[model samples]
Target: MKAIANALIVTIASASSALAASGAAADEGGFLAPLFLAFGAAIIAFQAIPAVMLLGSMVKGFFSKKAEAGANAR
Candidate 1:
């Protein structure tokens, strides 16, 4: 069962890669490519804000816990 699952995943990956390789054409919408790239970058930048906030909160919580533990030991 695991062998069959692995084979299926490999087949799907190769088929998709082949399809993607054939689909690209040099003459197809050069201007739209940069616009789409900028849009994707903007989306990533917008999503990063929450991730940064979460990391900051996690660091703050970690330090507070250490401080509390030290106070209790004294």
Candidate 2:
């Protein structure tokens, strides 16, 4: 649990730093600025997929176990 909390803190810090850097770069307004911004947004969006999937699986497992236990009791 402590390890997970540390990892979460690190991830948030890293993401905040990347976003700050990206915002600074975006203000420069070159040809590639929009492209880079879009790419960064895409990367963040893609990263969420696995996290969502893992959370979904955990919720499903928890409910399924409860359902089975209720059925067994009946």
Candidate 3:
């Protein structure tokens, strides 16, 4: 899907940039590594949060009142 592809692209780019920044900063200041690390983590979390919500909604639907009502109506 397009969303998966976009996530992959973003993850790859973020990882690459983080690595680059980390290496550059290691030679001078150590601050950028943590910043880039946080950036990469945030990117991954953003990508995963939607999927987690969607899966939670799907699981909730299986136990929901609406599902019971629909089953009774059938």
For each of the candidates, give the backbone clash count.
0, 0, 0
lDDT of 1 by residue, 1-74 (tens): 99999999999998997888875575667798889999999999999999999999999888873545666684
Residues 1-74 of candidate 3: C-alpha lDDT, one tens digit per residue = 99999999999998997777655434744799789989999999999999999999999988875645666684
Off by over 4 Å in 2: 1-28, 66-74
Name the top TM-score candidate: 1
Q: What is the lDDT of residue 67 in candidate 1?
A: 48
Cα lDDT computed for each candidate against the true fold: 0.88, 0.86, 0.85
Candidate 3 to truth, TM: 0.38
Residue 55 error, candidate 2, Å: 1.0
Q: What TM-score goes with each of the models?
A: 0.49, 0.46, 0.38
Model 2, position 62, has a per-residue lDDT of 84
Against the true structure, candidate 2 reaches a TM-score of: 0.46
- Candidate 1 segments exceeding 4 Å error: 1-28, 66-74
